[model samples]
Target: MNFDNNKLIKIIKFNLCFIITFIPSIMYLHLVEGGQTATELWDSFINLDFYSYYKMIFFLTASFFLLITFLKYVDLNGIKKTNYYLPAAVYSILAVLSSFRAEYKEIVIKGFPDRYENIFVLLGYLLLVVVAVNIVDNKKSFKLILKALFISAFILAIHGILQFYNYDLLATEFGRKLITPDGLDFFVDRLSFVGKKVIYSTMYNPNYVGSYTSMVGILALGLYSSSQKKNKLFISGILSTLLFSFLIGSRSRAGFMGFIAGTVIILYMQRQFLKKHWIRIFVIFTVFTLVFITMNARNLDEIFSDVLFPRTEQEKYLEGEILPPITEVSSEAGKLKLKTTEAEFEIIMASDQIEFLNKQPINVYNSKDEVKEIIFKGKQYLHHSFQINEKENYLIWNYGAKSAQFYYQDGQILMAGMHNNLYPLKKVESIGFKGYERLGSSRAYIWSRTLPLLKDTIFIGHGPDTYAMYFPQDDVIGKLKFFSNPEIIVDKPHNLYLQVAVNTGIISLLALLYLWGNYIFSSFVLYKNSDLSSWKNRLGIALMGAVTAYLVAGFFNDSVISVAPVFWIILGLGISLTILAKGN
Candidate 1:
């Protein structure tokens, strides 16, 4: 019985480590039919999307397996108590309660389409922390996990380098087939992800690629700094340089900032060690600098400009001579009119169809007594409701909570109000970062809007994975100023703190903050007391630096499933390492 239990524990530990190391690179694509009808603003045919579905399944299955095995091990033995439990418990309870009261129960359970960090996924994250702390009982296990992570980062960095040079492995036919399931050749052919200059590697978005490498790249440096052997040092230095080069290719300011933060932490923590080995640091920096310059030889100015001004400057909306779509109604018939400084035309809206002034009839409307909605490709994406006045006729088109109002004026259709877009302009509140609204790719705009929501979430939040449902999606001015698109959905706050505060309540945020604070404090105390020569102590510092980098970057990047699991697992390992160091 003991032998069987021991073997099971080893298997569970291996599975946990394997999943954590490889979760970022999981890109198996399968169709998710019947997407959310109300919330999805994009194509409705898919749900899991490309980067999200497989990662969720992989995490869920592995987490469940590790959790069940851990539970069995606990039943045979017993669980150890730690100071980390209180805050974890508080945060977990609040998250569960928030999910229970979520308005979109399905989303809270399964998560939003294209971004699945649902309640189950949240639980899985916590399970990672627990299992990581328990399963990693020795230095060998800990070193093994770090080595796997380093190798994964090395491979991904190489892929990112290839992508930067316009040689994306995934853009090839074989690459598409490699990511897609068998017999999905048609789906693979339909994929249009080729011809991208930026490098996102396997992490979906360039921003995410930045976030991921920021953590692991810094950790790679930590590994290099701590190693004594020449061979290990050489290998670690190469890994660090490669990873940092990948970070540069991502062009993610948040990522660069995160890398800086981690570097600062490492310097502060390993000041003595670094004083003796300053040459190594210089050599690694020189290598990365040369690589960065070589990779961006033609775009050096553009890269620097991006860092100086992170947000893309919004173009001023000049009142164009072109007229937007407008509806005009009389008792006799309804007409969709278009008038510009150059030309004017009208389309007659019949009871069930639209007829051009002198051309073919377009079967574009569904109506019994009056025209209701426009139909395209046998589907109605928006519900159109019209109101007529003595002056003009206006159309209010709604998709879920979002609505766009257009009014006919001077024979031209003019936009009146775009809900959720520029909500700050419509309503007044003491907004933060007033002058710097464009900072961090207009993260200030999102934060200014998101800050107002915290007052309502002091106790209980809307629910897990329901940030999109609650956020003001109709801020037209905000969208126009930040994104130049009045119709885009502001799905995430782009700030992890705001995401947690809005989705899981301020109380939960506080609990999580407490958990972070506890971990940092405990780790610091352990690090200060212990000798840095031991690989275990050096690992503790590396974990601290990596986790700190991730947290610092969280200010500009929200915790997505692609990168959040890595952070949580590293955090758990850090916690366990600290505890083990203190025990010694």
Candidate 2:
């Protein structure tokens, strides 16, 4: 009996370490399907992609291990005693209650099943805290975990660098076929690098990669500073530099700002350590910054233009003169008519904007430039105007089936459609402090629409992940008009605070805040008391920095399956370290 128990514990520990090390690689190995319509029981249970499936397995394994650990050792003391556990418990309870009382029960139950999945996520994180606190009782296990993390970060960073140079290591034709044996083409299309130039790497989004690297990079910095061996320090420094470079290539503004904020906090906390190693740290920072800047100068320039001044390619076109009035207008069976200059012209518009009408003889020119004499089928015609509203100005291009229409005002392209030559107009910019209003990229608009819905469900929200169902009916967002599309459906509030408040109500949001605040505060307190010269204390300080970065980034982004696991694991590690520090 004793031998069996010892063997089981060894197996659990080995599995836990393996899961932690391989998470970064597994993030890219998703089995993409056509859509989210579940046809089987397994599909319904595990609707998300490969990452979620792997996490589910991790959760089950951890739960089983924890159950065995409890039965054999009778150690349920960790959960009962932890300072941050109660808030987490309350948050979980509230989340579960909210799911049951959800207005869109179908959405909560079927559509976006985050409500249930989130329970597992929360439990998994808590279990990690418990298991890590118990298992990693010594410096050796702690070092092993940190080393695994560094290795994962190194692999991800190298892959990202290769991807930036258009070398997709995992996305090759043969590779895709190997991963998806079903020969499903949807996975290829979904994961293929098409229009995007920035490398998403394993996380699938540039923002996610930015977030992941920001946290990992700061942790690497901690490890580098704490290492006693010259070779270990050098390797850690290289890993930190690689992660920082990856963060810059991601081009995520929120992530960049979060990383900067977190690093500053860490530096301030470890001022004593900085006093001794300031020169070396400064050199590393300078070298990495210069390298990143040189590689991404052009990308930065374009991003600055788009974010600050807000100009598009279509802005170059001139607003032409409004032509003569339309005498008559009619439409029948996918064709339109305009009667002017005592001539009736039949026009057919192309359904696809990108496909040019090559079958018909048409004279196309920049509307801003001179309007030439157009003769279609030996009928002379001049530029004609059509007004949807008295205040709105519209330019109509009539040349057989290749007709296009646009709304132009004050030398700017307001809205355009069915024109292969013209670009979509940029949104109307508001003159103000360019932080959230401008840099938020219309998230302000999404949030404004979402706030009004919270009045009815202030205590317990419409339920977890049910934001999509109700968001479409929002007065402002439902009829929200962009360049061509009049109706837009916003699935998320875009802000994590707003997402939590609207999904699970203000009380749940407060509970979540408390949970995070308590952990951060406790971690910082531990860092302040520990020996500044010790590597262990420096690591604790670094973990604090990582948590700070994740929280700041979370303000701009939501927690997803890809990056959330890492955040939780780091949080657990910090908690365990803090406890150990207190004991010492």
Per-candidate total of colliding backbone pairs: 11, 0
The C-alpha lDDT values of all candidates are 0.72, 0.60
Write down the TM-score for model 1: 0.80
| TM-scores of the candidates in the order shown | 0.80, 0.71
Model 2, position 543: C-alpha lDDT score: 88
Query: For candidate 2, lDDT tens digit of each residue in 143-192?
Result: 77777777888888887877776776666776566445464545666664
Clashing pairs in 2: none
Poorest 10 consecutive residues by lDDT, candidate 2:
475-484
Leading candidate by lDDT: 1
